[model samples]
Target: MNPRDTEEMTATMKRELLCVLLLCGAVFTLPGQEIHRRFRRGARSSRVTCRDEKTQMIYRQHESWLRPMLRSNRVEYCWCNSGRSQCHSVPVKNARATCYKDLGVTYRGTWSTAESGAECINWNSSLLARKSYNGRRPDASKLGLGNHNYCRNPDKDSKPWCYVFKAGKYVPEFCSTPVCSQEKNGDCYFGKGLAYRGTHSLTVSGTSCLQWNSMVLIGKINTAWKTNAQTLGLGKHNYCRNPDGDAKPWCHVLKDRKLTWEYCDIPQCSTCGLRQYKRPQFRIKGGLFSDITSHPWQAAIFVQNRRSPGERFLCGGILISSCWVLSAAHCFLERYPPHHLKVVLGRTYRVEPGVEEQKFEVEKYIVHKEFDEDTYNNDIALLQLKSDSPQCVQETGSVRTVCLPEADLQLPDWTECGAFWLRQARGVYNAPSLSFLTASPFYSERLKEAHVRLYPSNRCTSQYLLNKTVTSNMLCAGDTRSGGNQANLHDACQVNMSVSPYSEPTPG
Candidate 1:
């Protein structure tokens, strides 16, 4: 019975001991510390308990002297003797008092004979305030010193209190300043807890918190935001928490409240109520022909196929009048006939031949009298159509008319007016390709026309007819770089003439 029973009991005891250790470990671990000591519970508290016998004794003495003598008689004394020969005062059983026998002689005892010791401070203003001494609560209602008789026996000197005896002060009851995250726990401490009190907190620019007797409301947590282009206002947004974000109600005893948001970075106008100026759009109907007619239809028309023979030769023509076609005088200088100078009616492009082919009998080729063979001026010439075909007079898609300046009519002859003969002398006779043609009565369809540009004689290689041959009446219109180099060169795009002979009848 002895050996077997002893072995079993020993093993069982070891198992039980291990279980107890595990349970205790789980229940008692020091928080925020690496050490875990079961012996710590019995250690001394850093602060003495207020209810302890020694503390009670000290408090009782303070209260006794403060009441019977200080409050009722406004005077008290102590019996302790201090140096500088010696100092003495009457002893009060409850209080550890102090007395100044002379200027520099102070004695610590139970009571003092002095009327009101210099060491003891007093507060007599309507709004009483004071600081703590010996870490004790002053009898605020007693009216001995700084105490605002509001809260019954309020822990007066317990806080670093501030009092305003006068009405005005630059400093408010609570002041505030922003704090950075690097601060102690992101905390902006104030006067009472440290040495004085003011408002401060832990909030970021994009974030917010509360402070200042809970009077200050801060952050954009409850506001709303709208994108720059948003059609509606704050309430219309589904997700806008606030102008900034939803960071509201971060209420605190001393927080300054604010609402902020990341404003939409709108580079363009979002709302239209604000005044703005924009160019008026000219809305016309019809096509390029209509555009040209809306203004003076006189364009520096390009007459292609000047030398071709047969009835299909003249690729295009410019309307010199209802009866005449202004063309390259050299086109007829060769003594060409109706077949050899076939005029393409309403020719817009050379590659795509005109839909209607007009067999015109060159009635008479009247070249400008001064036309020179070398530099061809009076390069201007009128090809009077045969009087036989009356159909030529009618306005058809193939044949049309462009007004001409009267014999004595004068114009500034600007290149933009299609008077670009000046530019033709120069190597760079570049014109913008017309794509958007204004609507009007002349053009049937939206046709893309060639832009005509006139470079000055300064850019010309030949000087013979630099300014003479390419006269003011003679204008040049067409894409200088014809092939496909023109940017807006669509097959049917047209440049509608804006200023028309109908509008300006005669040049000013």
Candidate 2:
């Protein structure tokens, strides 16, 4: 053997050993580096693969018991021995089972019960056993009972199962009252998920989850129900029962600013309907004398005639308020002084005065600010009477004020209305015009009345009035009589003259 060969082989062997050591070190270091990188990416590996044999056995038993009762894909389990414990989950396996026990089979504390012969507790039958033992109620505090420790059954179609702690142990009962299921999850659950079965509607006035068997056709999600329920003093959420008995439950909801039941029919509010007023008996026909106190608002206006020395009959007015009279603004065209005019009320005849007649001096007069003489628009005026008392006139059977119509009030076309005037020949409203007579031959000095029908605004426009400007504020009316012995034609002009104290006949 040569010494050089032996030395070379020895060096080779040492180098090979050093290379092997380096490879082993690299293998351990690389794995640690890779694990650190995986950790940075939120990946983790389990250090322990095998669980305690006793724990595995308990978990398998619990899984078998709990798989059937789960309403959803997940099921939660908890340790009965731990006082302050959390729920844990397991994969569901048996889809056919209907009953589930939430707490695993164990005693309620960490103390061993092997010598005492205390068997593992079964949540379903444990309550019944406790109730029967000693014939006394089970104290919840001593048993460490909580809402999480419950047994649920999901198979029964309707009125399934609800277990309530009563008479010391949980007994079959209805989940009528809300109970906390999980304090950390803020989930207060009703039992059997059928609290509102067969009911049309449910009101959750308090914050809690109400489980039911039927599907919700209409649900106010989040805060929508709170915002709209019983709004405007209306009743609670309205619902209709499923007539077919197969469809989901539905209810009324407010959509597009309107309330609709089941997204279809509209629901009527309690305040819907038209207001009505009492109808009077007296009527306006062709030319006739009005009953003595029939039109109590009538007033006769008088003015001092410029050509004559004393005051003479001018026009008529309607008393609207105690101190206010409504008339046509055109009546004041002559601009008579307020002191020179007088108003007489409760008078049926122009010359012959009534026993209940009252008189007043004009204090102030106001023509409409927007009066248009060319179109006769806004021809209304108000007159204030001079009086020592706040109320200018006392109301009586022959001196009542007329009610003003509301601003939005509408009347049908062709509605009949009355016109009133004064005639000297006839002492009352009855005064017929001579047939074939022209130029108002029926004129009289005493109060007279006639009827006319209202004309539509379109007919009163320039197209019908020989191009006369008619405005939206103006009203039109015409006589509707025909045939032999027809009544004289009544007009708005005649009505205006009868209701205005300052009106004078226009010169032809």
lDDT of every predicted structure (CA atoms): 0.30, 0.45
196-312 per-residue lDDT for model 1 (tens digits): 111222232323332221222223223223222111112222221112222221212222433333311111111111112222234333212222222222222223355573222
TM-score, model 1 to reference: 0.26
lDDT of 2: 0.45
RMSD of each candidate? 35.4, 25.6
Candidate 1, superposed: residue stretches over 4 Å from native: 1-315, 347-359, 387-391, 413-415, 419-508
Native-referenced Cα lDDT, model 1: 0.30
